[model samples]
Target chain A: MTRRASMAASLVGFGVSVAAIFLLPSVLELFTLINATIYVSMAILALSLALIWGYGGILCFGQAAFFGLGGYTYAVAAINFGDSTWAVVLAMVVPALFAALLGYFMFWGRIGDVYLGVITLTMTLIFFKLFNATAGDAYKIGKAALGGFNGIPSTPPLNLPWDVGSPLAPEDIWYIAASLLVLLYFGSRWLLRTSFGRVVVSIRENERRSELLGYDVRRYKLGIFTIGGAMAGISGILFANCVFVSPTMFSLFYSAQVIIWVTVGGIGTLLGPIIGAIALQMIVAKLGTLEVIDPNVVLGSILLLFVLLVPKGLLPLMQSGFDRLRRPKAPVPVEPAIRPTATPAARRPEPVSAPVGSAPATNTLGGS
Target chain B: MDLAVVVLLQVIAAVASLVLISIGLAVIFGMMRVINLAHGEFIMLGAYAVIYATRWGVNLWVAMLVVAPIVVGLIGVVVERTVIRFLYGRMIDTMLATWGLSLLLIGAATMIFGNVTAGVSAPLGGVTIGEYQTSLYELVIVAIVTAVVLALMAVLRFTQAGLIARATMQNPAMAASLGIDTSKVYAVTFGAGAALSGLAGALISPLSGVVPTMGVAYVAKAFITVISGGAAIITGTLSASTLLGSLNTLATFVATPVIGEVTLLFAAIVLLRILPQGITGKFFRRAL
Candidate 1:
């Protein structure tokens, strides 16, 4: 608990993470390295979900809308912007701006959970249909060509002018991806530790409480939503470089997959989602290679099992098991509130007005 | 006059299909808090069931009647008891869980059905109405949709069981306090929703080709219809679908079909911006 000891532990953990990133390919079997890189990208995407759902308390069903936008933006920019670092930056910024504008309307309007999810889903569908529609020879945006349904092909790989070797290879790309992942992971963690991040979490737990505490909750929510969208855009930039960006990348199914990664890992935990993405993708990919039986059947069964048995996700399940093993003989306190009772109308619904940390739930745009 | 007749028939056909899909979706949403993204999968499965059953020498109508509801209903029960039961109160998780179920169903169907488009012959053949050639199957679809709508309205309006379902949906704890078994209500609602989905699938299997990925296409439209319809039963869904479908149909006629679809999306977005409660919700409020 000493500052020196804490710093040492932190340094050690950082070293271990970096080592795992570099050495995971050699230690694991069957494209684990490539898989890890992709999962890292997915984790970036999942982080956006965490920021929105876990912290902001907004369940956006269409994070893939931003992801797809990021991907298309990156692909289009990389193709047009002459293989420079500026192209990648532009790709990230364009989508970030787009997300900020969308989030402004949604958050400012005071959309509730179900309505928020619907709006986001609809936005993604609109993007999908639009992308599909504009995919023609005549359609052109800057130097980038919109290929419609058949997406832009032959997108240039990452171009690091100062790198000593060929940056186009998977290994080089992996290094770049690994570096960016570290930066983003730490950057996000640091962001959450800041006042803004605290406000975001407060917003998630109770908007009304936060509002009453005199914080501008709407502005904070919009701010975080936009940041998450930007982070997703960053992931999209990486994704476009890793694989060919297509309109299908923006599909609801793809958005659903991002949620699955976050859920399977554990929402609210920083590392849980990345781990979930890596593990689930490996399982799906392996199952897909199996003969006779369908991978989708396996996926469905697993999803059902997870949702039923391990609702908080694999991380929480593992954590609980670890805790139990660490302290086995302690008496478990029974929660009287959760006890099952037949025809149970005894308990009253607790009026949770808002999370207690900061601000009240005030939709400022209502006045507008 | 000929062009007008063609447009009318097209509108009728589109309305029949739209009504079938929208009503089922509306009912499911009304009963269960679950916005079943996989509802389309049930429809797809029913279509496949009819396709396979017809191939096995069963009469098309009999196969459609027997296979659709049962197949989708059984899947619904399994889904409700297993995955969806846990996902209550968590909208994002519900969406994700249903989506996973959808992917599995679509993928499994692809593996089994080989991703080929297949169709079933309608029970009634083509009919000539005056100078126009109209399919009797289309007329049957329209009639069936109408009958189903009327039956649904009656059940929701008059039946004690329907009242319980509505009560449970509006307030689960209150309904339970009033002696309704909320768990049973939830299960029944889920089953009924699945059955409607299957029914829609069976009805439209002949009109649209049956394929694994077909459900994905319908998923957005169904959700859009429900949202546009204002989360109510019968009237909202029917009116929204008709309005949107007509817009879509007319847009296609006036411009390139792609532009029409885009225009519809644009209109919906604009409408969503203007009236978040949706068209049906606004109208119902004013009418009352």
Candidate 2:
């Protein structure tokens, strides 16, 4: 029975993926290919957010910083090295390294959650401001010059090792993206199922408890953060190849939008964010058919509604509802028996007081 | 001599406006623990208010007096109740939610008022201070922000409500135990922060043309100011503002506007690295 259920689930997941790949292009023409490519890039970004938030429980408000870093790094490299695959590798590697260095300093120095959010956010702002200023400068990393505000333009496309002759066409690019997405999805799933993955989840659930269990919490966080950064770097490489790289990629607005994407999709679930990216983009494409509504307004309204109403994300909500419908009806609906009885108030769990700086906020307040 | 003085006035005016908004943000953050990402949207609303009022033929200063704070404060309260209430304690969620909210507001504003930078006329063309003929309107912004800051300091020091706010910020449970309504203080403080941002927007609209995207610039600077001033979580947001304003004026007078901005951000980050607690901790230690 369990084997049947697992097989059914995998088949359903595969059906959904295949439908998305084939139908996405039919509804929107070749634009879907471009859209999928962008979503793939966004998925890489979502992975970064998921790793930081879902596993480490560090709410980074500026994953775009790393995304932008990877993008600019790739763009600069591409411009300099012409379209060398090796250059593309370096482009992605540089950002991952940079994120690792950033994580190292931040994690080791013991910047608590709030301050860590701020530090990363500040880096985002600083990068944009710096890059925005550098736009006019004749600064060249390799052969490519930093265009500053105008951004690097007309950069050569990626040169894959096995093109099988001609450059990777639009349809081919879509296939590449779909395949990469599949690999990442499965890889992330496998990673989370590992012992280290279990440790990461436990850290998210209770950092202090994990530390008391003698796990080096910061090292684990840094490792996962670097992985997230690498995923973002890979996404950036794909993004640079898809379209012209620009400074706007590094902007806070993009960073903020990426966070919204992860939230809209559901953070912890591996496949959820990809669903979110594709769903939101498709909705915007459909809205594009209606000439009246501005795309920004449509996107903004939907995102606002989703973030406010469906914070657990659309995918998770749908999955649970689907599971409910599929399941056999119980003779009596479980209520009190489902939840364990509340522990005695007198023997209440001690308030896990964080170091004044690291204290998990009980009250919701917006900052970074 | 004239160019130098005009540039100086421009610098002072810009810095002063930034300070007022940042200080307002700092105080709100100090009291309520909200970063208020939509603070810039409040500024945008204020600018629109002044613009609409000006079209209605109201005296600029009088219109600002009647409109900015009230409009901004009302929006603040509505937001506090509708959105911000859900965000308390979940800082990351709040940040992302407010960011989404800001995008919604900006998109709505863009749809209503096309994508264009609209200019508002300064009430007084120029007011002469000694040998310097400065824009009297710009100086007025500086004066208003200064007066407001002073009033806030006095309130925080003496008023019972202010004391309660300070107490709640320092120790929420203790304040609650003493029957102080900390939640009310948080809501009110958030509203007040929104109002300051609006006021700053209205005042600066004359010097800096109002645009939907203008909020982006202010958000970054305000964050920098908050960090630099180290104002009791959020109180000193103004101090960084004032300092940055002065530094901005000095930089622009000596070099280019871009250099001034770059320098300010660079200095702020450096300051952040050196003094984690910011200027507040530097000036006065909060007793543990």
* Residues A126-171, model 2: lDDT tens digits: 6776677775446666667778787777756665663424456666
Question: Quick one: best DockQ, which candidate?
Answer: 1
DockQ of each: 0.43, 0.35
What interface RMSD does each of the candidate structures achieve?
A: 4.9, 5.8
**Model 1 alpha-carbon miss at residue B140, Å:** 3.3
Per-residue lDDT of model 1, residues A256-308, tens digit only: 78777766676665566767776788787877777567777777667656655
lDDT of 1 at A234: 80
- Give the Cα lDDT of each candidate: 0.72, 0.69
B1-288, model 1: which lDDT tens digit per residue? 876887787787776677788666778775665678898898898888788888888788887777778887888888788777766765555666787788788878888898788987666778765677878888888888888788877887789987887788789989999999988778777887888888889888888888888887787778877877775777677777788778887888888787667666666666666667777667875220
Q: Write the per-residue lDDT of candidate 2 for residues B1-288, one digit (tens) a residue.
A: 776677767876776777766865676666766677776777888888899888998788866766887888888888888887866665555666677778778878887987799978667788775677766776777788778877877777889877887888888899999998777877788888888778888887887788877787777677667756764743466556666777776776688776677667666655565566676768655621
| Candidate 2, position B94, lDDT | 62
Per-residue lDDT, model 1, residue A75, is 76
